[model samples]
Target: EAGVAQSPRYKIIEKRQSVAFWCNPISGHATLYWYQQILGQGPKLLIQFQNNGVVDDSQLPKDRFSAERLKGVDSTLKIQPAKLEDSAVYLCASSLEGGYGYTFGSGTRLTVV
Candidate 1:
């Protein structure tokens, strides 16, 4: 099975600037999730997608964050007008509905200046 893939690995942007991250989930997996991991806390689910449909996004900051899964294969997360507090590890993970451990990518580390 192909593992999740993310790009750039790291990014630095000024506060109020915009940044985006990409993700490619494992093949055959039906559930994909994006999480924001702050300095010390656990990963918080920002959004979830089951195929091309969004399953959950209650925790996502709608005012500045947006996400979409196109063709039900890959996804992107965008944050416009970034904030200093937004600096964190953006993790992408996938799991099968039946039951399986999630496979996480190395993650895109973002820093706000």
Candidate 2:
């Protein structure tokens, strides 16, 4: 099976800048999740989506972070007016509905200066 695809493996931007990361999950997966992993920390869930609808976004920082899944296939996460604390690896994962096995993308690393 093809793995999840993510774009722009790395990015660097000054504080208050904006950046977006793209993700294409494995075909046929119905659940998707976005995570943020800071240095020396495990990935933290940012958002969860089932199909084209949001299942959970409580952990997402609405003021600066936003994400969406279009037509339940492709997804994008954007951070606007980023802060120094926003530096981390953004990960996208997908799994079958109600399944625990998730397939993850390589992720996009963001650096805020």
Candidate 3:
């Protein structure tokens, strides 16, 4: 089966700039998640969606971040007026069940320059 896919691999932007990342989950997978991983720290769940409906987005920084999954396939996350502290690896993952280990994309590593 194909794994989750993410784009850009890396990104560099100044504080307050806007950036966007894309993700494509495996076929047949019904759950998708976006996480922010800072260096040396664990991945923190930012948003989760079951199909095209939001399941959990409590951790997402709504002030500057937004995401959506249309048609229950590909998803996109966007950040506007990004902060220096927001620079981190944006990882996309999919799992059959929330209890199972997720398959992660290489991630979009964002660096605030």
Q: Candidates 1 and 3: which is better by lDDT? A: 3
Name the weakest run of 10 consecutive residues (lDDT summed) in model 3: 94-103
Candidate 2 clashing pairs, residues 3+ apart or interchain:
none
Rank order by TM-score, top first?
A: 2, 3, 1
Clashes of 1: 0
lDDT of 2 by residue, 23-80 (tens): 9999999999999999999999999999999999999999999999989998999999
For model 1, the run of ten residues with the poorest summed lDDT = 94-103
List TM-scores for all candidates, in order: 0.95, 0.97, 0.96
lDDT of 2 at 25: 93
Tens digit of per-residue lDDT, candidate 1, span 6-66? 9769999999999999999999888899999998999999999999999999999999999
Ranking by lDDT: 2, 3, 1
Clashing pairs in 1: none
lDDT for predicted candidate 3 compared with the true structure? 0.93
Model 1: runs farther than 4 Å from truth?
none
Highest TM-score among the candidates is held by which one? Answer: 2
Candidate 3 residue lDDT tens string, 52-106: 9999999998999999998998999999999999989999999887647888999
lDDT of each: 0.93, 0.95, 0.93
Query: C-alpha displacement of 44 in model 2, angstroms?
Result: 0.3
